[model samples]
Target: MKLISSCWIVDPSTFEDHVALLSSARALKFEQHCPLEVIILSGFNELQLDYVEELKALNVNLNDCTDITRELFLEYRHLMQDINDYEFLCFIRWIVISRFLVNEDYVHIDADLHMQINSSDFLKLFKGLTGTFGSPCLVAEHGGDWFQAYCHYFTMLINDKSGLLQLLGDTEISLIRTNIVSDQDLINSLEKNNRLPTLLSSFNLENWSVFINPLWPYITKPSSPVGFSQNGPIDLIGGKPVLFWHLQNDFVSFLGRYYLLVDLLGSLGDEDLVVKIPKLPIPYLQMDCSLANIIFRTLDGLYRHSRSGSSRDRHKTYDPLSRLSVTQRFIHSHKGREVFSERLWWENSVFLPLNDLT
Candidate 1:
């Protein structure tokens, strides 16, 4: 199976975090009985170059990491055109999957993650599934209160390239290609078009507890055991042995929640294991009470405010045709639209109707 990830230089800490991420993936590969291939799409940064060299020096594979040079970016200029760096990175990830779809299927992982266990079961489950994609779990907004921002983790198992191509029309593809909309918005559009994959019988995707998000408050309490169990060799999370953990956002934002876990994992006696606390390049001061709350809220507001009005509307609208801008309306109209009618049929089969049936 092929595993892909993308990275751009955000900061020194991010690079360090990626190094640790690769280290963990290397460790997990040693435990795996199945064949696995890892590839990385990387941006051009001197530090990134140095980091790649360092990883190579440590015997980590650097052969598959593709550098996004200006010439290469120009070749895939359609994907890079009109998008910010974030969108550019996202589009590259899609390209990685699209170009390699002949290999049957692959998993796309975010850079800020570490594997804690052999993921053979998880990989087999994804390979056996009949769907356009398999996500860890679907999470509604605010933990199921709203559908406006419904999303699954970007770390996904994708299959059925034809279905994906049909669902993302040329215009929609352009938007995605150009990074006009986020991947979450792309999933929302899928839901709108009734193109989302359904789970196979008795094979609930949510039942697979392979990965854990310790950053979420429900799993890691400030006062509880940090991520270890006295009775077991593996770390316990949500009453199960954790296989992987995602450490997203800035180091400061995740300071309290992830520090303990990072410390525990970093302390493992294995010479092959090398988990490190990601250091932020910028100076930051710790704060408490009202000051922290205000800063966080203000940051949230600014983030929301930065998003396009159309994107905001897209998230809030359930009907595909409602409140759509002229461009959006045109994009939603495609030459050969694919759709599925029966939930059971869609769930059990991979060859969904290539024409819109809804």
Candidate 2:
């Protein structure tokens, strides 16, 4: 099976995560036997020469998208000046995929993911599945009200790029508040048009349990692998092998509080294991039974409507306060804006190619 795997590398700080991704790919049995090309679509700050050199050493291809990304952003600069660098980078993912991938199947993995099994098997599995596009993790029902369908785009396999490009359309550079409008909405739009394809099967194990007990190694426990609901968390899957851990968010400044568990994964050796839940996070536990959470959610709904005004009714925003961590909440606060401003100043001065700006 001819395959090309691609991922975006925008931040220098995520160099370790990128390294882990490469290392896991090398560990794949199929990678050793078959011809697989790894392409890193680099974004800003011109990744440290050492990191680029290391990836090249592993036979990984680097396509420095710094200038191209800037040029593309320029096309939308009239309406995009206020958005952050990451938002600009988000728009470049599908563009890079479409441009580089020739006549072959491709898998798009996020930089933060850690592979447990051979990724080639993942590609082979999905390629044979019923659908033009496939995602290993299909979060069926998610959140209350809006955003009920959580289609995880972090790990996606597509037979070709045309289906995805046709769905995304030209509204590529837009933003929802301070963040890029997520791929979930794009997938939802595809579903609305009846273009969304069947999702590939994989263990939907999240490390939410790791947050409750840092020392507990849930990977070794017995949990039912099948019978996962589309909505709600996958707290129990007895003894099922996990395909990959979606170490989901940005790891630049804040690794989730449970990130220590990811570090502990090395201790269990390389084996397909489903870690049992010691205890779920306090906030997640409260959502079902706590009066406080209910009241807080009620207040949060009011706050959303109050702040969103008419736009609240126009497009339902999916952000829920109950899901935010201390660091996430901080980044969403007024102080976060000041911090981001300083960071943006630094980025604009150092990383951004100002000469290219019009």
Candidate 3:
């Protein structure tokens, strides 16, 4: 199965886009043995040279569709002026996917998504589902109450490119005066009208969990402690392994990375593990001085103190190895790079190889 993602760099200074794409590619290629092809706009050149080199090192195929994306953007410019560029990119990506798809089917995932399961397992799951659903497009049903019945575009498997192209072409866009109509909404409309042979399956939702606004704590099972098994982070909830975690937003991504670091450190079984808080880069520290980061840092300090067995707080010391719910296989961090730059853990000396962790 072919895996695809897209990147359009709006900001040149921040490395969040690079980190998201790189992390997703690394996790899939190294852990799942799946190669990822990135359909990037021409704006990719705006990123740092080192990041471009890193993408190359991963052997991530870069398909530059600058002219096509630009032309499409121009066509929809009048109707999309009020919409955020990032949101509009979501729509643009599907157009790129349509162009890329041919005889073979493709799985299109957001750049920020991190994979835990291997390609073979994922393919097996898809085949089983398609046998029953018989749909050209299979998308995960949203887990939240707001759009529970709608299909989420974060992860999609497309078997028919022409069908998708026709659907997009026939979609209508009204002038936006206030709220923006997301591509997800459009896709849902198509599905509702029976114009698209799309299957909104809960099979993916049962395994994938999205952590977005009002970042909720991960559901933990004290009886089945989370730790590294030969299969990777063993977090079982209700006897079911988590297949994916969608970490939406900056602060959430920051926390997600912290949790990941703790899991890795805890796997070592080092009771004396002294995780010194790294000094934050000036830009990141200054830009992300939100209450969430402050609270996180404060709690981090308290947790560190507890690890030394000095805190008098009634709550048990945060045990990295024991807390995570490992049911989700795909851990996605949306809008990564704002608060906690990956440079802290990813570049650290203690960072273990992906092969070792998975």
User: Number of the top candidate by TM-score?
Assistant: 3
Cα displacement (angstroms), candidate 3, residue 109, comes to 0.7
lDDT of every model, 2 decimals: 0.37, 0.37, 0.45
Q: Runs in model 3 with CA error above 4 Å?
A: 17-19, 30-33, 47-50, 128-180, 188-231, 250-358
lDDT of 2 by residue, 1-358 (tens): 3344545555555544434444543433334444345445554345677766655565455665555555655654445454455554554455554445533445555433333445466565444333322232222111111122222322221232344555445533223422224444455445545444433223233422211111112433324212211122112222233344443332222223222222233344633212321222332244465774575456556554654547536344323231223223322221211111112222222111222221
Highest lDDT: which candidate? 3
- Candidate 3 whole-model C-alpha lDDT, 0 to 1: 0.45
How would you encode candidate 3's per-residue C-alpha lDDT over 211-298 as one tens digit per residue? 2221221332123222222233433323345444443443344454455445445665744333343423332352377875676656
Tens-digit lDDT string for candidate 1 (196-262): 4423332343443342333232222334222222123344433444444454433324332222223
**Backbone collision tally, model 1:** 0
By TM-score, the better pick of 2 and 3 is 3
Off by over 4 Å in 1: 8-14, 17-19, 22-36, 43-60, 63-72, 75-82, 119-121, 130-180, 191-193, 198-207, 210-231, 250-252, 257-289, 292-358
